[model samples]
Target: MVVIGAGAGIGLETARQVRAGGGQVILVGRNPERLEQAARDLEPIGTATFDATDTDRLQRFFQDLSAPVDHVMVTAGGPFYMPLANMDLAAARRAFDERLALTLGTALYSRDKVRAGGTLLFVGGTGGRRPGVGMAVMSAATAALPALVANLALEMAPVRVNLIAAGFVDTPLSASLLGDQLEARRAELRARLPIRRVVGPADVAALAVHIMCNDALTGATYDIDGGQQLLPH
Candidate 1:
């Protein structure tokens, strides 16, 4: 299995889960040191450092692989939270490229490299389905991912492409963004969400592993947001 965006979040946890399942993992990310640390903890097959948006690099990485992989999990996009009025065109364009375009590139480039019946899983955002204030662009990109993967599933047939739409996972990335407000946000989510707690990386990772192992699941977007979509804003 290859885990793209294998940093300190859902990507990292997914790598851990796959490793726990006795599967070899290859960690890919833009940060060399971070990828190295993540691979060290998981004892992955190896680690590769490169931006997901680089199609040439992604293709070469797969081509150079010694053997075909059974699954490719993408959790590559970063956080972008700003109202349309405050959004910078350059930033929005970059976000779209990173969040959506890169995902498409990875899927297309790895289509043949992935073994038949293998899985291509993407991580999307819950805000796509339930958009809130200051998340217009983010929501737009997130909303497009499921549709994109659905079509890919058809085009890629037996390859089994799917997406996991998550919400407010309590990851290191989120903590850094939230900073001192992390606990406040967690408390608020715990009170508001139907699950009464902020979703953790492990929660989403478990679901991702399930989707990879379950042959019957494909061309679908599974929501694992602790019922965040069920709450009233």
Candidate 2:
């Protein structure tokens, strides 16, 4: 397995689980220091630190792999939310481009590098499915990812492609995004989510492993949001 964003959160947790299940992993992350720290506990077979948005570098990483991997899971990047009034057009363009490039680049470049029947997994969000103050761009992205994944699954065939759509996962990224409101947001989710708790990286990791293990699952988007999207908005 090649686990991107393995420095922390969902990626880190998923790598841990895979290793625990007797699988070897190549850990990839953008932060060198953090990735080094993460590799300490897992002792992954290899570690590469680079921003996945660098499409060329990503392609090189796949091409240089000594052997084909059984699975590739990318949990890199984070949510981008900006209201039209306050949006920085340049930043928005980077956000959109980076996300698409990372997704499509992984699918395109990993073609011959992933063993047949292996899976290509990507993470997305369910929160952006609805329209709101800062969700215009996100809503569009949320709608597009699964459709893209579905097509990639067909194009890749034998090598499955799937997406995990989550909402309100309490991770380091969430803490950074929510900042002072982190606990408050947790409280809100706990009070209203049908699952009665804030979703965590472990929840998503378990779902990710399941998707990787299940051969019948492909060209689909699995939602793991503690019923956040099912609630009335």
Candidate 3:
């Protein structure tokens, strides 16, 4: 297995899960310090530090692989939401491009590097599925991924492709995104979400590992949002 963004949160937790399942992983991250810290805990087969969005680096990473891997889990990147009025078109384009490129590059390269029947699992979100004032661009991206995954799954053949769409996971990114309002958001989810609790990184990680190990699943968008999508906004 290879876990991109393995430094923290979903990626880190998924690495731990895979390790616990007796699988060897090559961890990738953009932050050297955090990646090194994560490596200390899992003792990954190898570790690479670079932004996954760089297709050149991504291809090189696959080319340099010591051997074929069983799974490639992409947990890099995060959501960007802003109303059209407030949006910076260039930045939005870059973010959207980076997201698509990372996933597409993963599928393109993994076709050769990932063994037959292996999974290319991507982490995305269900939050963007809901149309809201600040969600225009993200909604498009969200709608784009599953369709892309389905097509890639076919294009990639026995090498499966899938997306895990989560909502409001309790990750460092979420804390940073919410800042002072983090607790309130958590409380709201706990009260309103069908699961009656906050969804944490471990929850998403567990789902990711499941998708990776399950060969029957492919070209599907699995939602693991503590039923957050079921409630009214």
Cα-based TM-score, every candidate = 0.94, 0.98, 0.98
Output the number of the lDDT-best candidate.
Answer: 2
User: Can you give the lDDT of residue 177 in candidate 2?
Assistant: 87
lDDT of 2 by residue, 119-169 (tens): 999999987888899887788888999999999999999999999999889
> Among all windows of ten consecutive residues in candidate 2, which has the lowest summed lDDT?
134-143
Two-way TM-score contest, 1 vs 3, winner? 3
Provide the overall lDDT of each model, using Cα atoms, as 2-decimal numbers: 0.86, 0.93, 0.91
Model 3 ranges off by over 4 Å: none
Task: Please write out the lDDT profile of model 3 over residues 1-233, one tens digit for every residue.
Answer: 99999999999999999999889999999999999999999999899999999999999999999799999999999988888889899988998889899989998877889899999999999888878998887888899999999999999979999999988899999999999999999999899988999999999999998888789999999999898878876
Q: Residue 141 error for model 1, in Å?
A: 0.9
Give me candidate 1's TM-score against the actual structure. 0.94
lDDT of 1: 0.86
Clashes of 3: 0
Indicate the residue-level lDDT of 3 in model 3: 95
